[model samples]
Target: MNETNDMAVARAARLDTATLSDALDRLGIVGQCHKIKGRDPEFRMAGRAFTLLCGPASTPPGTVGDFIDDVPPGAVIVIDNGGREDATIWGDILTEIAHRRGIAGTVIDGINRDVHLCRTLGYPVFSKDHWMRTGKDRVQVERTECVVNIGGARVAPGDLMRGDPDGVVVIPRAHEEAVLAAAEEIHAAEEHIREACRGGMRLDEARRQFKYHQLQTRQ
Candidate 1:
């Protein structure tokens, strides 16, 4: 992608996960979460193409560095730990390398370590929880190219991932542009409705005036 285009996508993604979730809901997608909470926010990641699906306990010792090295810049790494909250697949070292390599933020379905370090480094990470035990013993990467399950969704490589404080949502490659456009429209319409609501219009009135019911119409 062109640098300018990438920057544009990044800007568009600056909206928080809630807004993105609203967009996804307008486009008919629900049930997305961070998988981790209360950790300091690291919101540096913003992109729209190429997702990384990492399986649990994967990333044996030296391999994580290589994985970070190989992932192209501007790609999101979605780590799937099979919902294992006992071990952490991402930590300080991985976050540092990912930041240096310009890889987009990581989304792990399990746990993470080095929470403070990741915050200090300003790397974005979303996971189920945090634990002190390292993943070396319990976690092992079965495969990098396989479909990894994340919060009930099957995240594959090359899918578009947008995340922020609220949660993360995966966008399949085939529907990227369409989903984005739909999201934009939904955001604009919702903004208008909010303004109307603040201007003394009732919720139902605002909905009717702004065609809010259209959001429920399936595409």
Candidate 2:
């Protein structure tokens, strides 16, 4: 990653999903990935998105996860599998390779298998759920570097993706700076309120002083 993009990702990593979600709401952007969460509560990932789309297996069955080798380091693999849970699009093999390659992490709109391995290797994997069933003949790669729907969020290639224990959020590359600024302001306000409360100020007074109620209101 270039210095500019790397700095952006670092800035985003400092903020959690909730703050970023509020920032998106304040900016009128639908970047929250609903119903998608980390397989392990301790998992967190922040990086540029390397997007891919998946569909039902082909007549003769096509490949699954073969494009992983092409993904660059420090990029989060965002896979949209139509939220299918009957089969898994990820497994131990993918997790091990991703960890070895220094890939940021993986986020799936559907489910994954071998989640235990993910926790063991500390390879973050966020998805709707996990199952042991293989996606070998049930799912196939449809497109790479394409616009894909993750949860209810639209993720295009190279979008900024950040996930914490709560869930994943995508910040569009075009509006990332604005979103980041908004999140930073909100974070600072909240921190100020906390400091005031620690100094014996009433919670309500602190909130009022910081305009906490208006922080997430659309601008």
Against the unseen true structure, what C-alpha lDDT does each candidate score? 0.67, 0.96
lDDT of 1 by residue, 95-150 (tens): 88888988778877778889887788777877777878987756666567556777
Q: What are the models' TM-scores? A: 0.81, 0.99
| Model 2 TM-score (2 dp) | 0.99
- Can you write out model 2's per-residue Cα lDDT over 80-177, one digit (the tens) per residue? 99999999999999999999999999999999999889999999999999989999998999999999999899999999999999999999999999
RMSD versus native structure for model 2: 0.6
What would you estimate as the lDDT of candidate 1?
Answer: 0.67
Backbone clash tally for model 1? 8
